[model samples]
Target: MEINGVEIEDNFAEAFGIQVSRILITAATKKLALVAATEATGYGTSVIGCPAEAGIDGYVPPQDTPDGRPGYIIMICNMNKGKLDHELLERVGMCILTAATTAVFDWMDEPDEKLKTGQKLKFFGDGYEQTLDVEGRKIHSIPLMSGDFLVEAELGIKAGVAGGNFFILAENQPAGLLAADAAVDAIEAIPGAITPFPGGIVASGSKVGSNKYKFLGASTNEKMCVTLKDEVEGCEIPENVNGVYEIVIDGVNEEAVKAAMKAGIEAAVKISGIIQISAGNFGGNLGKYQIKLHELF
Candidate 1:
């Protein structure tokens, strides 16, 4: 299938189930809220090497937020409950709690899979910790040098899809980045999904494991690297393609992932330098859901 003269490859991006926690960080201003959110979600890109995969879902306006302040909503995902719990505890305590005028809250409620993040952090107040009832909902607050830090006692964690990805093949580096920028912008508008990769683009795509270094869990994807097209045995890089960029998505469900990919691909192909649209996966080994590019339209 062709979109704006760009060929859409007859391939799919595989996704799998994982647990996620939706965390809300609010502050007096958007810039300060971002500072805490950025620090909290740092070092969290992929499950391959990091403790969790996380990103800013979107910015929430003051009117829609519980605290009536500008803030950011983020999602942190991991394979199991224990890992998610540990990551949230560490990141929230060290990053968000330290920021000025910042407060934490559970954006979503799931009784069955709740983590006592605020309950755990309250101990930091020593013997002066307390709970307050705000709008009939009780939240824990801990004393700090700046003031009291308020947090929702329990955070929801439930199963969600991860590892959804697509590739942008372009004529050159600038063109590839242009397509990627458009793709990222399109995906950003959709709620319940996020591109966990840095700036929503992966320049160095990786394979499952290293060929020479056994200790390394992942290695560079040589076939996708245009510079090594002539040297690699199974190079997928076309002669006209001088660059390739990948966008990886994780969302609240399969439909959210599909929607994000659809929007991104549609926008990307409309750009000037995009050649062909494709996807990346570990064959059938990565995940169960396969989102075919052509079928998305």
Candidate 2:
């Protein structure tokens, strides 16, 4: 299939089921919201390298925000609920609460589900923590150096899809980057989805294990590395394709991942130097669900 002069290949992007948490970081203004969001999502791209995989879900308008300020929605995925709770407390307490004019809120729609976001972070108040119920939602106000930082008692958690990715093969680095940028722009507009890659692009993909190191869990994908194509064993890279970039996405569910992937693939395929779109998988052994690109398009 062709979309805007770009070809959609018949391939699948495999994904796995993991625990996810959606968080809202609100501030007095949009600038502060962006700042807190950037920091909260910083150093979080892949669980392979980072402890967690997180990204900006999207921008929340003032009307939709809890504190009536511009806000950003972030989703964090982990292997288990305990891991999610631990990372959320650490990142929010150290990063979001410390940021200026920022307050954390739960993005969950339900009230009863417990994830203990504010409940755990309240310990940072050193016995000065206070709680308030606003609009039927419980929020904890912890005093800080600047002022009180409000956060919800519990966050939402659900089984979601992770490792949703697509590879961009191009004639050169510039073309590959351009295609990846366009894809990210498209995916960012889709709700409940996030591309956690660095600048929404991954230049160095990894394989499952290392050839020499018995203890290493993962290593670089030699087959996709252009520089080492000639020297490395089992490198299947094509000629004239000097660069490759991967767009990895995480979403609340399969539908969300499918929607974002469709948009991203469509936008990416339109670039001039993009050659083919492929996906990353461990021979269908790892993830619970597999998304077929051809079926999505």
Name the runs in model 2 displaced over 4 angstroms: 109-112, 231-234
lDDT of 1 by residue, 126-186 (tens): 9799998755656888999999998888888888899888999999999999999999999
Using lDDT as the measure, the top candidate is 1
- What's the distance in Å from true for residue 41, model 2? 1.6
Ten-residue stretch with the least lDDT total in model 1: 105-114
Report the Cα lDDT for candidate 1. 0.89
Over 4 Å off, model 1:
109-112
Candidate 1 collision pairs: none
Q: What's each prediction's TM-score?
A: 0.97, 0.94
In candidate 2, residue 100 scores what lDDT? Answer: 93
**Whole-model Cα lDDT of every candidate shown, in order:** 0.89, 0.85
